[model samples]
Target: MIPLAWYLIFSAALFCIGLFGALARKNAVAILMGVELMLNAVNVNLIAFWHYYAQMRSTPYVHGLAFTTMVFVVAAAEVAVGLALVISAYRRRQTPVVDELTLLKG
Candidate 1:
């Protein structure tokens, strides 16, 4: 049986990688992908905790699984909205690069 600490460490590493991607990427779509990665990392952590600690015989933590499911739903919605916005921006500016979107001048 893999240790809980290992799962947590992996999740933390994934979260940090996602954070770096979100911060370093210039394309809006790439940033959105990074955000998704981060969300997935959180989900992994939640599930791991639920499995290791919440399933105790005394005080079950099944509630954490529910919260994790909600987070997944929210993450899906966020991806939908974010992708829509990226498409809209690309249509308006003809480029997906974040640095080239300075066209607010009328």
Candidate 2:
């Protein structure tokens, strides 16, 4: 049987990789992918905790799965909105590189 610590370690590694990608990447789409990776890592942790802790009690937590599902839905919405913003920015500037988007002089 796989250990819970291994799962947690993998999730943490994935989150860290995503964070690094988001911070280091210049392209807007690459950053978006990194954000999605981070979200997926969080989702994996949530589901793992739900599966291991929430289901162990005699009276299981019925709402754990529901909460995780809601989180996934919210993540999906966030990705959609973020990608739409990136697309709009690309259309306006013809460049999807984050470092080149310094034209917002207000």
Candidate 3:
């Protein structure tokens, strides 16, 4: 059986990579991709913990799975809304770069 520590390490690395991508990228789409990656890392950790918890309790509770599903739903909604805003900004500003689309600047 794979150890929990290994799963945690992998998830942490994935999350850090996502964080870096989100912070370091200039494109809005790339930032969205990074956010997706971070959400996936969170899913990984949730599933890992759920598996361990089930093993310890010797029961198949579905709370973690349900929470993960909700996260997926939320992530999907976020992407939809975020992309719509980005597209709107791109249409108005003629650019998708995060630094250039300064709609908030008055």
Alpha-carbon local distance difference test for all models = 0.89, 0.84, 0.95
Backbone N/Cα/C clashes per model: 1, 0, 0
Range of the 10 consecutive residues with the lowest summed lDDT in candidate 1: 54-63
Tell me, by TM-score, which candidate is best: 3
Model 1's alpha-carbon lDDT is 0.89
The regions of model 3 sitting more than 4 angstroms off are: none
Q: After superposition, how far is residue 20 of candidate 3 from its true place, in Å?
A: 0.4
Q: Is candidate 2 or candidate 3 better by TM-score?
A: 3
- Worst 10-residue lDDT window for candidate 2 reads 54-63
Q: Considering only N, C-alpha and C atoms within 3 Å, which residue pairs clash in candidate 2?
A: none
Expressed as tens digits, the lDDT of each residue in 1-87 for candidate 1 is 889999999999999999999999999999998999999999999899888775465778577789799999999999999899889
Ranking by TM-score: 3, 1, 2
Top lDDT hit: 3
TM-scores, one per candidate: 0.89, 0.88, 0.96
Q: What's the candidate order when arranged by decreasing lDDT?
A: 3, 1, 2
C-alpha displacement of 58 in model 3, angstroms? 2.5
Q: Runs in model 1 with CA error above 4 Å?
A: 58-60, 103-106
Tell me each candidate's RMSD, in Å, in order.
Answer: 1.9, 1.5, 0.8
